[model samples]
Target chain A: MLTAILIMTGIAIVLGAALGYASIRFKVAGDPLVEKIDAILPQTQCGQCGYPGCKPYAQAISNGEADINQCPPGGEEGIRKLADLLGREVKPLSEEHGTEKPKSVARIDEQVCIGCTLCIQACPVDAIVGAAKQMHTVVAPLCTGCELCVAPCPVDCISMAPLAETVETWKWKYPVHELRSAA
Target chain B: MISRLFNFRGGVKPESHKTESSGTPIDQAPLPKRLVIPLRQSIRSTARCLVEPGQKVLKGEHIGQGEGSLGTGVHASTSGTVVEIAPYPMAHASGLETLSVVIAPDGEDRWIDRVPFDYRKVSREEALGWLRSCGIHGMGGAGFPTHVKLGSGTGIDTLVINGAECEPWITCDDRLMRERAAGVLSGAMILRELIGARRVLVGIEDNKPDAIERMRAAASTIGDDVAVVAVPTLYPAGGEKQLIRVLTGIEIPQGKFGTDFGVQCFNVGTAHAVHRAIHFGEPLLSRIVTLTGNVAHPGNHEVLLGTQVAELLALAGPKADTDRYIMGGPMMGIELQSLGVPVTATTNCIIAASPTLFPPPPPEQPCIRCGECARACPADLQPFELYWFSRAKNFGKAQEYHLFDCIECGCCAYVCPSHIPLVDYFRFSKGEIWARERERTASDQARARFEFRNFRQEREKAEKAAKLAAKAAETRAKLPEAAATAAGTAAAAVAAEPAASPEDLKKALVAAALARAKQQKAAVTPKNTDSLSAETQAEIAAIDARREKRNTQDADKTP
Candidate 1:
């Protein structure tokens, strides 16, 4: 009985020391889990889910502060990816976020526009450029077309325009795969 | 056993008939009278066309320049006249139209006062920038901007000059390194200095002893800054990622770059160009092209940009009645539709061939479980599964199987018992996934923007209603006092004022909606809630107190 007690005590002390050492030695500075989650998120700062950017949404998801379904811009697929990352059930996009639509950008018709720069200030990505009284123009490449600009246009000059596709910008999506035996 | 920790798989291996043309030093092909130089040479947005149609241009004159940091300028391939500017057939199998500037050579390859280099007099950054203006890109296939490659500001510990020339039947780099080892070595020194590396590793395959000796002597003269390390002659040793692995035993993780490993690999040919750019002030306007196979005179040629394949193939001796043409090496080079495919910076080997040079691939058959393909897969992916999945267009499941990981090296198909074109499937799968991702991202962005806009609109509508109601209440309160006898008459007029002006009513509504939106925005934060007017809070508290008091009074009455 005495020998068994001594062996058990020795084993416990060694295990405890090992665990303590490992806790300090392998400690990562930043949360790798959060970094990985952030990497997968689309960086569009359209705040449709009420969060400012994908990183904030990732943080909110990590902290259990926000639902992953709030971002309509992520759409059903994005929500699914977030769900998988968070190990939560995928939920349908909340109707409060509005329905999914094709990507478009706000543009002011130069001829019709009265040199109002309200849209410029309202643009989150700073995709618009014009003086307060100058004819506004959209930097097509920079425009995410969040339509944040459209609401602020006093003259109601800004309208949404569909993005044009070209041969270079077009990339084919990945095809499907069937799970098979590794022979 | 080799540790399969590196999860690369599902590569296709085509018949590598490399030895056919890689036997001797590059020979010269007669320069064509005219060279059609395109403004956009590298993988960047096309340069703006500067010379109008019919404008005379000199050999060293600037044709056009790239827009952003990743772009390189286009120079005259030869003293030429700008003939046309429009989308022309590109050097791709798709025969895709890309914006090109056609230049007709005047044949007088006159020199523009070229800048000669004095190493002691110039700074390294200036040399690199001058090379960019001269338009040097990686000549070993992926024509990434050479300046961009050198400009990676990482504190490189090692400079890897890839002299392996592993791609079969492509000896342009080999020929350049062998004939001009001094120049190639000089370029390596420039790269070493640019990267600030303590050690320079010139990785050459053991196959070329002649080239190895030349480079070894050059490195010795340059002190111990650069060392010539000959690796075992293996196929694809020249592949940038694979070469880094073979030398350093370090895997560059996905989405991470080679510079991340403190090692940047450059083709020996590219290093030669860097030497010319730094030393001679010469832009990469020309390159050594291997012209062999199905030709009467089988030799390598130094080619200028915009030289039609037809012209080179003609110089190489016309293809026989049964001849087919390929660009680059036989293994990875593209098969040309006609000899008309304009030679870009990417073109190194143009394989004009008959059945003897490139036998047609046999009809694909079902896998008999021989597993020869698995052994050949450089990427180690189960291509059999990918093939089935891609055929079904099941991209999600294909991605789950790590379709994005395949480098499309084309090894599995070479050793397959049934020669399946695995690269095509991988490419198709990758393309599909990219398209779907782009589609999803676009739609998601649209939806979010739409919701936010509607929220603004809804708030505007509600505000207008509130403002009008407040205005009506104000008018009604003052009407009776202001007009005692004409109280009812004035009341009607006041009501008309609120009803008559639709524009004013809309503006007032929008203001009210803006206030509501501000309130909604504030609800999400503690600061916003705390900063709310005390009166509003008191009113809410009072309403709650009144409801409680009324409920108690009602309860007492009920008893």
Candidate 2:
């Protein structure tokens, strides 16, 4: 009986050492869960989730400091995706954060722009290009519709214009079944 | 000679209503008063518009030059003055407007100087480039640039000319082969010579006997080894992959080209266009359009590229009860929003849809797992599962079921007992997946830019700090040297004062710099508002308060 017990202990100690060595050798730097969560989050960098950016918000979520429903730019769909990823129940988007709106890009009224670079400094994605005391223009394709630039504009020249549907951008809508609806 | 043919998977045999339009010979459509030519005629990059508003252009003038290798040139159909370059309704299902060059015809169908080149005299690359400049695209509804397909002809062994006009009520190809079989054969021979293919096979549906007979006669006259084989009459037999399979017994997998299988397929109409461009030095300015369905005279007419659909219908004597127009054929066609849309390079047929002739589809019923769609799918994909996944917005699951393999063929929908628009669901799923992918790419780009901006700002701050530190060290070094020099020249008491510790001197410098910055800030005052009146100041205060309130409201509204 003593021999069996000693043999079992020996096996346990060896396995423990192997696992300990593995933990050190294959140690992953930074939280991979945060990177995954950040990927799922629409990288709008709008800070609508009460965080500085998407990465910080992802870190907060992984730390259990922020709720999955706090992201308004991601909308209810995003909440569902996060819930699925984290194995949590899907919840409605939090109203205190904001409401979901159609994707848009910021447009600056060049005539009204007072040659101030305040909007350029305020852009999160650096989509606005200008120098000090120079008229600024927003690169429409890059602007994440963050609205961060609009408030900082001294002349209030910036406006969010919803993307227009063209032939290339047109999408086929979901098919509605009348018979199923009646049933 | 009887060539061994291969059969494809599930397909449906719909009633062919082609007899109505196939009886008459092809006729030339009258020149439209104004032609609205869209620059994006091919499936790839759009052509760059060369003519501006009010510019005079002769017939066959290069109005839009091809942008890239995949792009094909666009030509003026008739002598006209460019009226305007603006967005006009296109012959697309979306009914969206595209940039179009509108030209008013000058009643003179003047031709540009035509210099027909002998392909035999020039290098193969030069010949292909000539075809690109001629704007010869596949007239088989895909509008793929002919040059790109011919350029990738290194490993191609068999060239299959698709004459299988299988879509119901569309006989443009059938009419073309019957009337201009020699031209089609000549073009095929040229293509064979260019690609250096050993054998040429022409696959025509058995339903169109006249086209087969005429093509065979033309092949014998040319004394070339072009086999005109009439395969079984099957719907979608004219499909590029399907026709390729029927001719060469090769199944090209999804996301792969037919050249990988040592075969290349070209439409019969495309072959004719190639002939006209190479032999006659003519660009693809007109195509044989089948004008049928709810029209008094249902026949085929060689219509110009930018002819308005309404004007083409009028020539066919569209019935008064005609309610709508459908482009292409019944199986794979889009209901045009308005007849005012211009005919593009891909516009092969225009069916005047009416209530009595073509009734609306019955209300869609839930799928009972009947598997009829699966039985009718030519691509052999599971349509029912795709429909369910797409409806649930589970794009990942839909993709898992090989959703992209679906060619948007209406066979599944055509056979579905529930009358579900299966193709529409597939299209919706594909569009959503593409759109999501595009959004992801854009977001990735934005994230990179944001991170780079942050990195740059941090770098700038570090650079400034380093410069300041270097300046302080230089000052410190100079002070010690000066103090040593003073010790040698004057009394030792000056150097014996402990030299005022470097820490103390650095602290004093920082304090002095801060004090100077504060003085500068105090000196800078408001220039315009310095001498403002009391009323103006009050008004400015009120405006500031209002602005503050509005900003908060705006922030609240932002998502």
Candidate 3:
């Protein structure tokens, strides 16, 4: 009984020391789980999740302050992915944030734009380019379809145009199989 | 010579309707009223448009310049004036519009200055660039740029020319070999010289006896040790990997090039185009398209690249009940969106499909685990499992089963007991996977940009703070000097009184500095006021008085 106790005590102390050293040596500087969650969230920066950006939202989720179903741009597909990652039950999207819509980009009406630079300032991704009192244009590829620039346009010149499907962007649809029962 | 041949597992033998179109001689199609040539001809990159609207172009003039080594040049099929450069419906599975150049033919049939390419005089890289300029792509319906395949020509020992023509009702290659055997041989010889290969083997399906005899006779005349061997007639035998396996007995692993196996494969039609490009200095402006399926005069015609499918089908006398048109073979062809779509470089066969000829597929049924698809898959993959995984939307599981290796040959679908469209599911799964990958990349890029913007904003704030701090430091540095001067001047005044302490000297210095600031403020004059009228000056004075009263009131409240 004495030898067993001594051996057990010695093993526990060695293992504890090794674990303590490993924790310090392999210590991550920041919450890496937040980074992984941020990778899963679509970086639209639309604040639909009630956070300032995707990173802040990820931090909130990591802290258990935000729900996973709040992001509408990520849609149901995103909620499912988050649920899979967090080992939680999949939930429907919240009703208050926004409904999922087709992907679109902002287009500026060059004629009506007064060159006030308001929309440019409102753009979160810096996808708009122009000088003060000059016509502003949106780089379609860079625009994240956040709808943040629409409200700031004084002349209501900025419109969210749904992206048109071309040969390059076409995708094959899922095949639907209808099965008839033997009964 | 009887060369030993290898066989690929899991292939189905459907009834071949080659005799319907292969019996007729090749005919030259007349110039149409308009030709709409798409800029995105090859698979890699789209050619940049060189000719604008209203520009007159010769028959062989390069209207679209190839982008890079992978891009092939596009030429005007006939001398004409470019009517418009706009988007038109393309012959694709998606039936979407692509950027095309519309030309109204003038019927002049004029030619540009043709000069033969002397490959012996120039470097291999230069010759390959010339080939890219000649618009030579694999005409076997893949439309892969030939120069890209030939560029990596080192370590290649055998050049296999594919004449299998395995797909049913596609006999353009068969007719080409039977009629233009010499040209194909010459192109093979050119490829051999360019790649420095020791042997050339032409693999034709045993179904095409006449083509084999003619190619053998032509090879004998060339005396270049070219071997013309016949392989078993099987569906998809003409596939690049399949033909290579049959000719050289080498299985190219997935994601690897055939050149890595000391062999390179080229279609017979591609070989003929190479001969034309090098010997006659002609670009790939036209191709021999097979017109068959529910037509009165089924034959092969060398149609120009941009001719409308309707016009070409009219020559073949399509029946009145024809409902649709298919672009490639019946096994792997896509149903054309409209008859108005133009024939592109990859168009080898156009089938006027009718209800009687090609009926609708039966309604899909649930899988019973028959395993017939596995027996019929040419790539030796399990099709039933892929179908289930794809049905369940489990892309990860499908990928684990090597879903990408399934070459959508329709063999599994043709043999499925449940009439399930297996290829469609595979296509959907592959597309979903690609789209997901693209989204991930896009999200990663957006994240990087967002982070960079945040960093930049933080840097700008820090820079502004530093500038303000530096200015405050400068002011503080100058204040000590001003205070010392005031203390020095007041030292004489303090000496008359009793000995003053250091605290008293500091107080006197601050008071003198405040008095100097007040004097300086009073001495300053406002510009643009000297030339103003008396009334304007009086108004400005009233405004200043109101501002001063408000400032005193604000200070009183705060204190």
- What TM-score against the true chain A does chain A of each candidate get? 0.70, 0.86, 0.85
DockQ of each: 0.13, 0.59, 0.54
Q: Write the per-residue lDDT of candidate 1 for residues B1-559, one digit (tens) a residue.
A: 1222232223333344545556767765556755666665643546776788899888778888877886777888778688888776667655556777788777788767788766456676676677778787887768888778876556788788888777666677767767899999888887787767878888887777877888888778888667787766666666777777777777777667788888888888788888887788787777888877777656677887788888887766855654678787666676786655678878888877688666777877775766675666555567677777886777788887777766666676667667777677777777667777765575456436534655676799999999999987775565433333333454435434644576644444444446557667877666645766989999889999999999999999998
Candidate 1 vs candidate 2: which has greater DockQ? 2
Top candidate by DockQ: 2
Model 1: TM-score for chain B: 0.79
**Per-model TM against the reference:** 0.66, 0.89, 0.88
lDDT of 3 by residue, B1-559 (tens): 4458899877889999999999999999999989999998843568899999999999999999988767889999999999999988888889888889999999998999999999889999888888899899888857888888886568988998999988999889999999999999999999998887889999999999999999999999876568999989988888888888887888888768788888888888889999999999999999999999999999999999999998899889999998888999988999998777898877999998899888988888889999999998888799999999999999999999999888889999999989999999999999899889978887887788778888888999999999999976665455545554545655445633543576754565565567678778888988777798999989999999999999999999997
On residues A40-109, what C-alpha lDDT tens digit does candidate 3 reach at each position?
9989988988998899999999999999999998999999989998999999999998899888999999
Could you give the candidate ranking by TM-score, starting with the highest? 2, 3, 1
Model 2 docking category:
medium
Residue pair clashes in candidate 2: none
In model 1 chain B, the worst 10-residue window by lDDT is B1-10
Pairs in steric clash, model 3: none
How displaced is residue A173 in candidate 3, in Å? 1.8
